[model samples]
Target: MSGSALKPATELARGNSVRTPNESAEYRRAREQLLAEEIELRRHIERVAELRRALPPGGVVTKNYEFEGEGGKATLSDLFGNKQTLVIYSYMFGPAREQPCPMCTSFMGTWEGKLPDVEQRVAFVFVARSPIARLIAAKKARGWTQHRIYSDASGDYTRDYVSATDADAPGYNVFTRRDGSIRHFWAGEMGPSTADPGQDPRGAPDFDPLWTILDTTPEGRGKDWYPRLSY
Candidate 1:
């Protein structure tokens, strides 16, 4: 009868067989809202990037800290291993701890494969506040041979970087040279907490891209997922 009374099969076969002007307008409005939300999200990301760039230069550590390397004794600079900039991640693996932290281990597992690509841009190292022998054993067990590993047996360097408080936590610190002096650029200890919004248990924020990617499959990186020294 009316133009709106199209055959059901026709409507089903051609998705746009019949739509009132009002329906089209409502669809456009919904699309505009989604686009606006995307734009706002992009703006928020840009703001966060600006804040990261605006961080003030940090103080340098004047005192040299000693570490044990595969080659024997080494200094903090040795961790750099001649790279211009050093990115150190403080791993939560100390002597007294019950076990090596699983979250840190997971992060390190990702790093193991990524180290070669990253080393091309900047030097990367993992520092544990454990004995050199203990740290080396862990590295060997985990098959982490591509990247440099060191032990800050004494907590001096860990404290200097603010990655540890008398006790070490999983954290990352970046250092660079400004003029003739070294300066800290960025540090993050609470990254795990920040990245895992699902931990809130109240209202879940948009999940992190890393977690979301892992979540797209049936097996998913399960809770029992952990890095093993020997796999």
Candidate 2:
């Protein structure tokens, strides 16, 4: 063998040598560095959440809009339905769209499953720019009977909340009250973090506990993802 070359047996013998205490200490330091990075990442996320909570209240609702509900005609206040807080998810469905946006459909599915739990804490409803009849038809077709749905046919409510585009933009907004005044709390639009290639079809964050838990499995909730309306 060349002077610089070592046989496999010789290399194995050296590689099997025991590590010294100092070497183990260095390894532990590397591990600690990785742990520190994880802790820092968590802190950054928490900071963003705090900022969301700190957002100042926005415009007040000067106009009361009408909507058709399961019972009959309802107003914006009907959505709150005596609840102190409200969460409005502005779905993308409109009169012109051929079908409901798939991403919105997936999110609605998740919301449907969580409706009971959410109602126990705060009121929640899905809003769309389409007429009430159209919105209700879509919901029935999807078998989404759990949560309340509303129509922003007049578009006034969506526009006032900053969730609607010049035409119609899909968004999710949260609202709460302070000293008897309703206020905007949070708003989210469909984007890379919510929807993109190689992401959940529900168009939600990868940080969702449901997705995180599924990621730990061997098969890992494979890439072929879509929400099922039935079955």
Candidate 3:
């Protein structure tokens, strides 16, 4: 809605030239309607992103959370590197889990290819409660070469930002350092309570392209099916 030329989405759909061999008139009519909706959906996504960008400043980060990284000790501020903003993924690889959460793994795995492009603007880091060595092992196993990762060895950062208790879950948090002050930015706020009946809790504009890609297929992301570490 906000970006590029403001062409009428419905008009664009009406002018669509896509046609299949031997397609029925009824099918074309229905497809045109679907295309209109799809265009509207794209506009709606841009509108939501516009609103998200306009949000007022979020809470100030009060603590200097520590983490263990490849370069030894680091703090929340240190993660920002040269960028003004930092995006931290609180993955569910806490010490208690036998393996990292499959869902989280699936999500992070998708990010691997995009890291080079994404890190150009914001510093992206992956945080887990497991020790640095264990996390490094997992990263190597997964062939994740681009994203920076660290261990919330003390669980302080995890408890404050990820979850307060033992029910470890995956979370995405954004932080910004502006004018010598560090503050919280947007986060993926969608969760169980926001889910439609029979649908899993998921963020809008789905962070994982896996779900978005599946949504275009005949078989959508089923409610019960989920990613696994292994087949």
- Count clashing residue pairs per candidate: 0, 0, 0
Consecutive 10-residue window with the lowest summed lDDT within model 2: 1-10
Query: lDDT tens string, model 3, 87-110?
Result: 999898888888999999999999
Question: Looking at model 2, how many pairs of residues clash?
Answer: 0
Model 3 steric clash pairs: none
lDDT per residue (tens digit) for residues 38-68 in model 1: 5555556666667777888777758777876
Question: Relative to the unseen true structure, what is the C-alpha lDDT of residue 96 in candidate 1, on a scale of 0 to 100?
Answer: 87
TM-scores, each model vs. reference: 0.67, 0.66, 0.95
Comparing 2 with 3 on lDDT, the higher-scoring candidate is 3
Could you tell me which residue pairs clash in candidate 2? none
lDDT of 2 by residue, 142-185 (tens): 88889688877777777767443635666767777657767666
> Against the unseen true structure, what C-alpha lDDT does each candidate score?
0.67, 0.68, 0.90
Q: What is the lDDT of residue 113 in candidate 1?
A: 72
Off by over 4 Å in 1: 1-43, 189-212, 215-231
State model 3's lDDT. 0.90
